[model samples]
Target: MSRIQCPRCQRPQSHCLCPLIPCLDSRTRVLLLQHPSEVNHALNTARLAALGLNNAELIVGEVFEDLPRLLNQPGYRARLLFPADDAQPIQTYGASDEPLLLVVPDGTWRKARKILHLNPLLAALPRVTLADGGVSRYRLRKAPGPGALSTVEAIVQALQVLEAPVSFEPLLRPFEALIEGQIAAMGEETFRRNHAGK
Candidate 1:
């Protein structure tokens, strides 16, 4: 029989980490523009990030037609989380009554670019990139570019800068759980050998 998968986190029953998900109330609105191909990827962190945050939303598509409407709503400023040459560091944006709408594209660099190009609203949004942090802890997938970050890491860093630092660390609980579980399953010797670079 096939293993039962948890619909929420999409991990198998024994490996499910939903119970560790954090409940965070964010002042900013986070919307994940995910590639359809990333939906079932074992290493995908966008869904987990969304699940942890109360104000987060996940939309799977290459071209989101409603993006413009969402942006035009009152009392919110929209910014795309991407590294364009013109993108300013996210830390520069201080607190405000105008809530922030952070649109993060979750996929390969090429796919993310496709999403940006296909949607004029996405392309036109002000771009903001995260501050440089340590290397990624994701051993299951490869990052696509210089200074790349996992989707979850990006969200955490953004929350730390935009919200409170304490507000985002709780979300890392399940993320660490996922990594630990995978390491155990892979065995010490194999995990050490494979993760030498991480």
Candidate 2:
């Protein structure tokens, strides 16, 4: 039989990561546009990110029919959190400046691009990229390249940058625990052989 899972975090009851998840608040709202394929993946980091933040939402689909309404959050300017040649670096905001509605595409590089391809309005938003040198802690998958990060890690880094002096580290606790759990399940020898160095 399948193991019982927590309704919230989706991990099996014995290994539920809800306790480690935080409900941190952020000035910058996060909107995770996840591809359907990622919803059932073992490491659904985008779901974790959505749960950890008070100002976040996770929507799973390819073509978002309500794109206009979704991006029309008041008192915030929406920006796509994807790297591009013309993408602007996310920066700390002043007290009086309007905060960002950070719309992130949660999927593999190709899937994320496909989401953009299907939703032109989402793709047309002002783009924002994280600063360089961030690395992925997600060991089970081969990263697309250096500086690649899991969805949660990218959100953490982006929040840290946009809300300077405020730490988003708490949001990473559940993610870290999840990684450890995955590594343990796979056995140290296997992890060392396959994912440790990359």
Best by TM-score: 2
- Give the Å error, residue 83, model 2: 0.8
lDDT per residue as tens, model 2, 1-198: 899999999989999999899989999989999999999999999999999999999999999999999999999999999999999998999879899999999999999999999999998999999989988878788888877999999999999999989999999999989899999999999999998887
Candidate 2's error at 118, in angstroms?
A: 0.2
Worst 10 residues of 1 by lDDT: 90-99
Model 2 residue 42 distance off true place after TM-score fit, in angstroms: 0.5
TM-score of each: 0.90, 0.98
lDDT measured at residue 99 in model 1 versus the true structure, 0 to 100: 68
TM-score of 1: 0.90
Q: How far is each candidate from the true structure, as Cα RMSD in Å?
A: 1.9, 0.8
| Model 1 RMSD vs true structure | 1.9
Clashing residue pairs, backbone N/CA/C < 3 A, model 1: none
Q: Which residue segments of model 1 deviate by more than 4 Å?
A: 92-97, 142-146
| Per-model CA lDDT versus the true structure | 0.82, 0.94
The C-alpha stretches of model 2 lying farther than 4 A from their native spots are: none
Prediction 2 global C-alpha lDDT: 0.94
